[model samples]
Target: MNIVVDAFWDDEAKVWVASARDGIGIATEAGTMEQLQQKLSIIVPDLLAEDYQGPFEIELIARSHQTVAAA
Candidate 1:
């Protein structure tokens, strides 16, 4: 099973939030991108069925925006 996870940096919240399409059943936040990915590995399997076999892939799509003045 291939999973698609979306991530974005929340300026107000000051964290990286991870979300997936409906039915993926994943929503989480972390202070950094690395932390978020680590969380995903652990959470993904638990969300899967008990009968699901080993080996699944995750596709993480992250988007972010920022304002840099006078670059």
Candidate 2:
């Protein structure tokens, strides 16, 4: 199965939040991108094991925003 995870940096929360779509049930948040990725590594397998069988792959898509002033 192909799992797609989308991550976004929440400035107010000061953490990276991620969610899975397209039939993948996943939602989590972490202080950093690395932490978030690590969480997915463990959480994904457990989630998939419930309904899916055999090997699975994950595709992560992340988005972040920042404002820059003209120099």
Candidate 3:
């Protein structure tokens, strides 16, 4: 099984946040992208275990939005 998550940069929160794009109903945040990725590895499996059994593969899809002032 494979899992796909969507990550976004929250300017106001000043952290990286992620959610399950495939409807796994998971959301998490971290100070950095690396940390978020690490958390996902651990989090996804644990959440899945609640209703699923056996091995699984996860793929995270990250997205960020940045606004730059006109110079």
Question: Across residues 1-71, which tens digit of lDDT does each residue of candidate 3 receive?
Answer: 88878888888989988888767788999998889888988888888896888587777787887778999
Candidate 2 Cα misplacement greater than 4 A, ranges: none
Rank candidates by lDDT, best first.
1, 2, 3
Q: Per-residue lDDT tens digits of candidate 2, residues 11-32?
A: 9999998999885669999998
Question: What overall lDDT goes with each candidate model?
Answer: 0.88, 0.88, 0.84
lDDT of 1 by residue, 1-71 (tens): 88899999999999999988756679999999999999999988888858477576888999999999995
Residue 46, model 2: lDDT of: 91
- State every prediction's TM-score relative to the real structure: 0.86, 0.87, 0.81
Q: Is candidate 1 or candidate 2 better by TM-score?
A: 2
The number of clashing residue pairs in each candidate reads 0, 0, 0
Which residue pairs does candidate 2 place in steric collision?
Answer: none
How well does candidate 3 score on lDDT at residue 11? 86
For model 2 the local lDDT of residue 64 reads 97
Candidate 1 residue-wise lDDT at 8: 95
